[model samples]
Target: MNDKKITKESLVQMPHEDLAALVFNLSTIIQTQNEEIANLKELYKLRTAERYSSSSEQVGYLFQELEILDAVLAGQPEVEETIEVAAHSRKKRKRANACTAPADTPVCDVFHTEGAEDTMTGKDGIVYKRVEDKTINKMAVIPRKMVVECHHYAQYKALDVEAGKDNKKINLPAKTDALGASPSLVASVVVSKFDDHLPLYRQTEIFRREGFFLSRQKLASWVITYYEEL
Candidate 1:
């Protein structure tokens, strides 16, 4: 393989000895560049403090430093990475190539489980019921209800209390469903502000610019949580 050609394919083709030599050369160049940086820093400090007697001396010193700097930098080798150009362009997905899911796919279902809902949580957390059939409503315009059957002797006492049925007799538990805004919306708002480097106040201003109202305090907290989660 050529010294410069280190793409995945070329790397595979390189002889072991040549690859080892390339690695050593790259490491040596990195060290040389680091040393050159230190030397330049020292030179900068020394020249800035001195009051030169003549413009010619100053120019002379500058030329000498330049020569030294060039020589040091020239001694350092350039570091190049092997790029797999052929593989890269193919892997990237374009919007035009996106696939859509089937429109008629079934999503919602109702199943009766021999388990008590009190096992999860309640207004007062407890479970005690022989059997309870409950319908959990879905969050949509056309909501689907999932029916779950409770097991014998429910896990907690509150299950019986919430179901509004005797522990002995089995009955369905009714729960009121009130749709609230999804937390995903808040998460999305935070993602835009933090990851995109838009300050909360600036984002709030942009919302104002677009004739949308968003509170600054809420934006600030969302951005904070967004970064913390990341």
Candidate 2:
């Protein structure tokens, strides 16, 4: 039989030289596979150590010395003392942002020119308001009531009263209905609900406090109508 066609049962009948050659080839293949597995495990360990390591491993003794220097400087007494410190200079602090008042903003000036007497004495001694400290503070002023517009249109009928004859009666439409709401008002309500996350029922209560009896159902209808028209 050919050597290529030999089975496990015919291995015992094979020549000693051919059997030794087959064993050597099988051993070489197993050794190559084992080396590949060991290389793969080593590469995995290196990658894991590089990626998952803690940030503290990067902090060295130099950073520790800087932190100790900062603490020692901060704990020093306010009085002058002959103490030696590391030659470390801190960066200058940045200035505050420049603030400009709006052109339309109304400015009201208040002066505290008058001084008051201090009756109580402190550890330093009695202190009175000698210098004036002027500071600017911005605040908002809410209106007592929201503006509600009312439009009135007068109607006149032309009659031939000279001949004592009456013409057909004509009625003119009102400038504003009982609802008396505007497009801007509806827009404000919709923005407050969606953008501000306010509910219609809460809006209704707010309107009630503002001296307007608004219903959530009406506001809901307005929202639906506004979207539908858009």
Q: Which candidate is the best by TM-score?
A: 2
Alpha carbon deviation, residue 209, candidate 1 (Å): 1.7
Which 10 successive residues of model 2 have the least lDDT summed? 169-178
lDDT of candidate 2 over 1-230, digit per residue (tens): 23476678868987999899888887998999999999999999999987997675475534778889777766754553344458854444433333566789887766654554434356888655444465877665657456767756454555566634454433534222334566788889988998987899999999898788989998887767666656
**Please, what are the lDDT tens digits per residue for candidate 1 over residues 127-221?**
55544566775544463232333334323444455556644543423211111212454565667766886667786787677666777886666
Go through the candidates in order and give each one's C-alpha lDDT: 0.59, 0.70
- Scored by lDDT, the top model is 2
Q: What is the lDDT of residue 9 in candidate 2?
A: 80
Report the poorest 10 consecutive residues by lDDT, candidate 1: 172-181
Q: Per-candidate TM vs. native?
A: 0.21, 0.39
